[model samples]
Target: MSSQPDLFDRSLLRSRRQRALKAAKPGADFLLKAVSADLEERLLLVNRSFGTAVDLGGHTGLVFKAIEKSGKAGQILRADLHIADPNQSPPDLVCDDALLPFGDQSVDLIVSALALQFVNDLPGTLIQIRRALAPDGLLMATLPGAGTLTELRDSLTRAELEIKGGAAARVLPFADTRDLGSLLQRAGFALPVTDLDTITVRYDNMFALLADLRAMGATSILHDRSRTPLSRQVLYRAAELYAENHADPDGRIRATFALVTLSGWAPHESQQKPLRPGSAKASLAEALGVRERKIRE
Candidate 1:
């Protein structure tokens, strides 16, 4: 068995997602829609078409729809924890993000948007995804990066410290872009790349931001989160702090969402490989027209 400590409450996350599904409205999934469009744009840059594609953790079918619209895959399947009604649009499979059902080298492409951040064992999940892809197949995913929800975290921490003399974790910790890139390399993906996109959203007040978070099912699900409900006093104080610290001149507060996109391909002999050390014929000193210095023994 793996010895990694569990950082997220998976059960609570599932419950929250299910609740979001029931309460979802037209614009509640704005983030997902944006990410899906970005994924499609990236796929358009590739010239080849895929035989089969899997939309892993494609909540509400937005990513699946984006993949379908891209016309880059012959067959597309959607997988998620919750399945829609049989009469309505339903996922091809219902499964957890940590456990994928595809066979080895079976899928030509896999896309996941805004779903990998909640995974407790992200490295293992990436390894599974790499194994599931066919040779030279591609994986593209988006995850919330370290800069997301910074203003809210600071406001909540300060308010709780001032009112209750202590603070509990109110937000989920996100992975760093560099760390995620390294994880992709460790998972046996070739030509791994990670890039960040920061989107600043303006809200009238802290309450508005909190409502959006709740509607997105993005409230805290940390395993170490405090069980006691936040008192109204603390909530009001948090709002006050948020307004005092993060508000703009027009009386609007700003929230940051850092989306990190990761892309890599399953290893194949045809892919480009880095040159071996000491294989270059020309020396750096000669190339730069400078004398090389040697350290004294």
Candidate 2:
């Protein structure tokens, strides 16, 4: 990727999340709900319990609730950028996503869902999360991958260019799976794993899809977004294009959402380690019953 100025307006993103939280209702955020479910499923695979855990960017406390129900942690702390009313269980902290209010290596576990993608400095944020985790602590998170919202991004760009004569950045560029895994290693996370989950949702039309995105607070917060509101002509054209290109047999358009789920752990003495090169005692050719040949240098 070429060097560029920060693509996202983080302040605007925070405002959007705050609005979404304020307007929260049951079943409003299907994506977050899905992500939380996936997070909980991953948590279930781990047989160990944490003494203390923190839910970073815990929007609407969904991750917190999941951790609570699983009983994976004796105590869980919730943190977010918005000042949300704790209602029953108050959040342990409320601050910017980039800022961690905990001591270094003090947390036993950290989990986040559908939040890290909006941060301006995702690498820096991951580094901070790694620093906050106690030795052997686990980190599990979900973020929109490179393939997320491909249909909408394409339709919007073509529509904008056709109607407004020029297009502005409409969708934030997402991190590639390989890059994310590399970032985890750079941040000192051990046994880093990155995988993809593709969810295809059907919408009656583009408007319905757009509404879902808005409710999820997933609208574009690109720093270079067009200052002018999207004109009706462009909106209509986009809808037409979306249906023409992505419509299914039932006429409902299909929207693809690819989520990158990552899991990593803090380095500890007990964790599994890779064997050094040339350390194996047996030869692969002998084990496989294949002819072995050596070339003279």
Candidate 3:
């Protein structure tokens, strides 16, 4: 398939996120609070094993709940596209630019949470992540993958097509497990590991789930949003359609989150490299009687 314009673009998605935050403020907060434990576990693991770490796309420090509490790190750098203040500063904060402003391989570990999906130049970003890491440094991050919001998105699209005559843009674009694995390989990481976790939460209604997205500061941020105020007509229509078509039998809505976690090591020169084409003593076909037959067949 052809690559998408902002499919993995972070800046574009980051710009679109504020709207979602505004719309689902309460929900995003609740959702992040809910996932705080899991995120902390991921963070703690990063810290205990690797003393000095850098948090990329480290929005508001939601993921690293225990950073300040621990006396472990010599320093932990918290980086983001935009940060209000360093808060405490030693594990310094820097707003993002086109590239990471750090010396090569200076970081011991890299941690990012729910941030990879927004990157447009994903491979390049991974390469940069690699470059930022010291030899044997670890990179751990999370992103949304397939099966996220399946019910809501599918119902909304169906409802719009049936009544509104056209469908709205996608709520989010997510890669599947296989796609993520391939991306890890392409990024030149050693022993890349990718896995998915399915989290299902029940909501009083559709609005509740939307709220979660807001508090998490993870809402859709398309470059284009019709360029004008969203007409109440569209808004109301969207809500009505969502409720009518997606409501559960118990009157509760279900929101599903598929999170992909990736772990990788920067490539080391000591690792084995594939041999040159003619470096082998003899080709297998030459030793076997089927040599000519293998070539012809």
TM-score top scorer: 1
What would the TM-score be for candidate 3 when compared with the true structure? 0.74
Better model by TM-score: candidate 1 vs candidate 3: 1
Which is superior by lDDT, 2 or 3? 2
Q: Rate the local accuracy (lDDT) of all candidates.
A: 0.90, 0.86, 0.66
Per-residue lDDT tens digits for candidate 3, residues 176-292, read 988888887897788788888888878776666666665566666655433444345655565676666666897776778898888888777865567888899977767884545
Question: How close to the true structure is residue 284 of candidate 3, measured as C-alpha lDDT?
Answer: 75
- 261 in model 2: Cα distance from truth in Å? 0.7
Backbone clash tally for model 2? 0
In terms of TM-score, how similar is model 1 to the real structure?
0.95
The per-residue C-alpha lDDT of model 2 at residue 64 equals: 89
Rank by lDDT (best first): 1, 2, 3
RMSD of each: 1.8, 2.3, 5.7
Model 2 pairs whose backbones collide: none
Best by lDDT: 1
lDDT of candidate model 2 versus the reference: 0.86
Clash count, candidate 3: 17
TM-score of each: 0.95, 0.94, 0.74
